[model samples]
Target chain A: MNRVRRNKTAIILFIIPTLILFCTIIIVPIFMDVYYSFFKWNGMTAPEFIGADNYIELFSSKAMGFPRTIKNAFILAGLSVFIQLPISLFMAIVLARGVKWEKFFVALFFTPVLISTVVIGQLWLKMYNPQYGIINSFLRLVGLDNLCRTWLGDGRTALPAVFVPILWQYIGYHMLLLYAGVKSIPEELNEAAKIDGANSWQIARLITIPNLKPTLQVCTIFAITGSLKAFDLIYVLTGGGPAHASEVPSTLMVDMIFGRSRYGIGSTIAVFIIFLCFFFAVLIKKVFKTEVD
Target chain B: MHGKIGKGIGNKVIFVFLCIWALVQIFPIYWMFTFSLKDNSEIFGKNMIGLPHVWRWSNYIDALKVGNIGRYFLNSVFVTVATIMITTICALLATYALTRMEWKGQKLANSLIMLGLTVPIHAAILPVFIVLKKFHMTNSYWALIIPYAAFALAMAILICESFIEGVPRELEEAACIDGCGVYGIFVRIIIPMMRPCLSTVAIFTFLQAWNELMFAVTFISDSKFRTLPVGIQTLCGSYTTDWGPIGAALVIATFPTLLIYCFMSEKIQESMAAGAVKG
Candidate 1:
């Protein structure tokens, strides 16, 4: 009894500082986000309780076009899972099979993942620079000068322009994750398939892809959640754009709090984002849940 | 015979394809570097793609001296170091208590942390901003450091949990028999064993708080307290046409992270992979 009590006191001593910080910063804010979502205050005055009106406004406000932003996030998630993951998967498969200088290419690809996103934003911003940027310069170099308008300034192209760097930067992260998974797969499986005359494509499709589904699910969750949280790059690149063309929930949340001082609406957006993130996370897990067929 | 030839061709194709992708990955950074070394003439002139004719070493000086990047760099370094030390120690303690010691509320604490891993900081920062504003912590170092440490706790604790669980409890028994208490065992036994996970956790936390933007951009309205991301954002904004110094500022911001990653890529990569699998 004395020993257990002593250990209990020790545990409390060990846990309190972290417990206070984490709970205050992470847990309390979540509840507070929900609490503040009901108010209509400017974040300075005492919050006037408005009773879900902010949520109503969030859903109905055409100007916010929050659903559009949510749609955009989902679109990004789709592209990430379908386009980005496949590219990374292909690279992982190739690297796993056999390639000289494999480690060099892996490090090269993953370097961008380690890079600070703000710097990446700056790099891409310069790439999308109107006058002397590479994309425009390349267009001119290829005699497609007529196609070059301001990539970021033009709303039609801004989202895709922002998406491209995001796609490039994170491919290696997913590639690494999938590569780790690929590396762990039994080599005998591959050798047996090869002995049975499976081509590289067939071996990958038949053996590797099936085994990689769980890792793919992890990459999916990361890609989706990451897309939902996409702010810094877009914030630096377009600041949601010349006209809110690339606005995501994160940027829009910043806009609400700091830009418009609509703290209530911002909290409302925050609450919705939390819900969407949870929804997608749970949904993805369920989709990837192993079924005993 | 034909199959061997076909396989050889396929290898050649995969090699070329990978080279193109690697070039795509590497070129932007190299291009950024070259422009960082060019003057306005060379950057805005027809030499956009080529190497800088005259290396403008002054771009670094200009960016640091004029662009507020130096001050922001200091701020980032301060916040990053503070966040790392606080989070690492706190997470180590909490994870130790949870995993290695007998404790009530362990399951609850673990679940709360799991919940935290899912709670996006950006999504919840609105209220946190309000809370900080109420306390006048805005624009203060505490605002960034405290939150950075707190936000990092979830992942750091989670990673440490997996590692500490793998640590054999037999050592703790031996220490206990030698008159060591829980704290003594944790400090002397578990801490030494946790070196690998601790480094990974430190690197992860460092990268996170260093590169963080949303909170920095929002919380620190004062330029003096601004970190590298916010400072670079504004600097790049103010100097849109001056690609040289702006790229230099970016290169400054990107340098330390790229250096560390290049040196310790495998350890970092495996840790991140471990994190994903554990999740």
Candidate 2:
């Protein structure tokens, strides 16, 4: 056993490959993002350092639309927390009440989470097609033809149109998380509540909701950060299009780097996203901790 | 008697509501399949949600032949398989080392690996592209495989660490007493015990790599190396008027994930819940 413990070669062989890959792919890139954020360069030219200008332009330049993207992301994060999480909580509570086909419903709802975002985007794109889409067709069928508009085409409806699939896709993910939380609450508590003349609603409000705070906190963080990092569905759905009406930080970063070849500003957005995720994670944890205390 | 009747009615209403929600969840997928088989005219005018009347399986063939979905499908399979194999092996050995073996800086290594979780892949795109370009690895299979495996390691290791810790040390002690070396013990004792954890990691890694679009689109511009998600996106662009082929492409791209969900959903759900709790 001691000979095995002292075998340094075995340990190095086991750890080094993963360690190198992890660093190259995750850690080194993060530092490089910060370093690149300070420079001004297109991809073809040598980078020139212009410390703080990129950050200044990002915040102050109205034309750049950086603040608008942040506002868009905040809207998404707000919707995830307010709208998405509540639906998930409601479903979780109902399913956790030992309903029939509980496992079946959970799996059904989780189906969307497993599919590719590109596919979801394509599905919704066809759904929102003004001429042939099922959404408009159903609307027209119901004698509400006036209510149908160009969903992904117009600026007014495009943002909400893009946000719907993003919110809809993850309902099951948060539900599953909260369902596990709801299931983990000992059955004894619910049974005791029922015996004490408590109704279903009463048990849910007093016992179930109170005990779900930890899972709710985790769900909230995932929702918020997930919104912050949202790119794929939006990219495929609208390409942040109809004149950047639906731009988030990610799409904007991709456009800046790949579309416009401004690696410096792109890296700035990348670093900003990283910082925002960490900030919100710590902030949510602190907030949840204080509430628990 | 009145109260009992009302309670029964309420339960029925809740049941109906749950069924409606299930329909909402599953309807788009059903729509995808239906439209995939219809021509553009029927899809647009005659049949919205109904099954295709003619059943034009040729849309799928066109997606394969003209849209180059077959090529992209192979690319996705190769990348996903390589990613799963690499991530599974690396995460297994690394988890063993991080959890069981005694060494200096193990704590640092463990924390650093875990730190990979909170780091968003979006943030790493630029620098990684630059580094890969420097080495001329861009537009190659290694380009996607390397980053996909690297990013997957943190969660894989986390999942593996929890499972590996549960394996009894007595088995390893017995193996050692029989003069088995370190590699021998790892190969014989630990690897066999890790089958469930390996599959969990494999499925998780498989989904990420299979569905990944941003890197597939960015790192590899060559159509030869394009993946399924990127291929579907391209199909959508080129087949705008002929959305049937795009639908067919989407259905093709989505079949594997749906298959996984059909078979191993419970395991995936459990792994996700466990990962969330630990994270």
Candidate 3:
């Protein structure tokens, strides 16, 4: 058995294919992204190396709006953590306490996540349609006609408007994670708290929330990192316009590469986005760590 | 008794809230179905929320015929199927080697593969385009499949690794002692035991490749090789005056996923929860 398990030929044969593919397609491209960021190439000519210029321009060039996109992403992340997670946590706790149609609600809530982001974007597009959308129609019927404007067309509203559906789509996802965490807490722990004259709020705050620390940490990381990389819905809904108001790093990267042929700048944005994700991921883990210790 | 009454009221409030949230979650899909069957006037006019007056089912036909969504659908299916097969097979075999086999750099290799999870798809776009262009693989199905499979591989391997770890070594040892070789033990013993894990990987891969918009849009410009999400976006662009056809295209694109979820929501949820730990 030991001899068979240590067969070098079998091991090499089994792992080599994936290792090569993963390297070429995933790992190699990441390094290439970092490498390409230092060069000024238009995708047609020989690349000219301009070390750190792209990065410098990406931050200092006001026209690039890179900082604004990052700010927009932070706002989205803020809303996701503060608003979306609480709603999900509320739903998870209620359902975990045993409710009618518990399984049904879970399945239903997760349906949006199953559907493509493009489809969700389109649905919300119609829902936000100024002339005949349900939102405008309701606003008109209720005599708040002033609120009826092109939600995706106005620069002031485009960012938040795009965020509504993006946030809406993921509620069930966070809820499911927290739901699993809530369910995994032993029933006896809750029973003991109850027997000690702890009310439901006390039990939830002390027992459930602390017990859910790991899951909450994971959820926070996902929400923050996901916000940093948010692209599809914003692309579909606004394309980072009315005037680049809704641009996130991912969309800005796409615009740089395809829209303007600024491949080097695009790679710079890509690298920045990657850095932000790793930075936030580590920061979030630290924050969650201190709370537990 | 008063406390019991208060508890009843609380449950009632919670139920109502849950129902409302569920409705908010599902209303859009239901609305999509209804609006897909409505013409311009009904969709924009009084019949927005209620049932369509005419139920113009020809909108689906129009989407297939005029919008050319069928070609894109087939393209998406082909790409998604290839991605699933490549990702699952590679992930399973590599996981077997990583977990069961003794090797010098096994831990290092496992960590490297796991690191693939942190590398977002956006980070690879520009460089991959350059790589694909060098090979002249752009505008081909392989362009989409190779990258999609690569991106999905890490998560699939993670899922497979956890499942394979649970299987006792006794089975493999017994098989080996009974004259089975490494290949024989892997195929005859391990592969059969990995059905659930494989399915989870397949489903997760399907979700990734099927709805992928970024790479599909970036790499493949040829209409002949375009996938559903891209096609649907184009359909939306072209049919700006009339949205019923766009809704129909969305439904057509969404149907397979919804159908899969209907049967395997539990599996999908479990897989997503596990795969999501990468973030």
Candidate 4:
């Protein structure tokens, strides 16, 4: 009994500090996101309870353009899962087969993930500059002048242009996840396939890929959810720019919250993002679970 | 016999693929470096791929002259280091108890901490902002430090708990046999055994806090308190027309992170992979 009491006290002491911090910083704010979404409040005034008016305005009112932001975010998520994941998986399979300069390639690939996203935004902003930027200059060099556009400054090109840096920045991250998974597969499985006259692609398809399914699911979930919450790079690149061509949910929320002081609407946007993240996360798991069978 | 030639062709194809991908990954950073040293005319007029004509170092000097890159660098160093230290200590204690100690509510505590790993920063930024405002702590170092440490605690504890669980119970038992108390066993056994995991958590926490922009941008508006990401964003905003200085400021802001990644990439990748899998 004495020992139990002592252990209980010790555990509480060990856990309470982090518990308070997590609750105050993470958990409480989620609840508060819901609480504030019902009110029509700016940061300054006492919040007036509007009770779903914010949500109504958020969806029905076209002025906020929240629907457009949601579409943009989903587009990013789609590209990440389809275009980005396949490329990363291909690299990981090849790299896991053991290549020369693997360490050097891995380091180079992962370097961008280490740098601040804001810095990456600035890097691409320079590249996309209409006048002397590389994209336009290179286009002119190759006699593709007709194809060149103000990559980030034109609404026509800005959305896709914003994706380039974001794509570069995180490719290594997803690649690394799949690479670790590939490396964990037993070599004998591949060697066994090879002895049976299976080619490299055949070996990868029959032996390696089936084993990588769980990791594939995890990487997919991460990529999709991460895309849903994407902000910093977009914020720094264009602030959803060229007339909000590249606006995403997080950027739109930041604008509503901070720029216009529409706390209620801002909170509504926040709640929307939270729901999307949770919804996609759960849905991805369900989809993956079905795939396993 | 045919397999050997086929394998040879396969290797060649993969090598070509890798070289193109590597170029795409690396060319932007090289391009940034080249432009950082160019004058405006050289930048606008010269070949887009060429090195700076004069190797002008003045861009760096002008970048510094115009803004608080130096101050922002120091603030980032302070906030990141402070956050990492506090987070590691808190995570270690909590993980030690959660993994090693016998107690009630262990399951609840563990589940609660795991849930924090998914709480997006945007979802919580408003409440944290309002809470800090109420405390009159916005734009203060504490404002950034508290939230950074709190959010990071989940991942830190996650990584540390897994590592601590692997540490053989025999060591702790042996230490206890030597009359070492709970604290001594932790200090002598758990801490030492968990060094690699600690550094993994340390590097992760450092990078997260260092590159973080949302909290820094929103919670702390004063230039005096601004960290590198926010400071550099504003710096770019002011110098939009002048690519050279903005490029220079970017290179300076990014160099340390690049350097660390260059040196410690394996640990960085391992920690990231672990985080993704465990979650």
- Pairs clashing in candidate 4? none
Per-residue lDDT tens digits for candidate 4, residues B1-279, read 456788788788899889999999889889889988988888886656788778888888888878668889899999999999999989988998888887778898899988777678898888888988888999889899989999899999999988887899888887877777777877898889999898889888988999999999988889999999989988988777787888888899988887877677788889888877877
lDDT: which candidate is best?
2
- Candidate 3: true contacts recovered, fraction: 0.74
Which ranges of candidate 2 are over 4 A from the true structure? B1-3
Deviation (Å) of A80 in candidate 3: 1.2
- Docking quality of model 2: it rates as medium
What ranking emerges by lDDT with the best candidate at the front?
2, 3, 1, 4
Please provide, for model 4 over A1-293, each residue's C-alpha lDDT reduced to its tens digit, 9 standing for 90 to 100: 22422466667777788888888888889889999999999889789999989999988988778899999998998999888889999999988898889878877887778888888888888888787887888888889999988787889888998887887789988998899999999988888887998977788898889999989988988898899989998998889977789999899898988888998899889888888888888898999899888
lDDT for residue A192 in candidate 2, whole number 0-100 = 96
lDDT of 3 by residue, B99-137 (tens): 999989999999999877767888788888988899998
I-RMSD for candidate 4 = 2.0
lDDT of 3 by residue, A173-199 (tens): 999888888998999999999889887
Question: Which is better, 2 or 4, measured by TM-score?
Answer: 2
Report the lDDT tens digits of candidate 2 across residue range B198-253.
87888788888999988888888889899998888888888799978888999999
What residue pairs are clashing in model 3?
A: none
Better of 1 and 2 by TM-score: 2
Model 2, TM vs. native: 0.98
Total backbone clashes of candidate 2, pairs 3 or more residues apart or in separate chains: 0
Task: Name the lDDT of candidate 4.
Answer: 0.86
Interface C-alpha root-mean-square deviation, candidates in order: 1.9, 1.4, 1.4, 2.0
For model 4 the TM-score comes to: 0.97
TM-score of chain B of each: 0.96, 0.96, 0.97, 0.96
Candidate 1 vs candidate 4, DockQ winner: 1
Q: Is the docking of candidate 4 incorrect, acceptable, medium or high quality?
A: medium
Q: Lowest lDDT 10-mer window, candidate 4 chain B?
A: B40-49
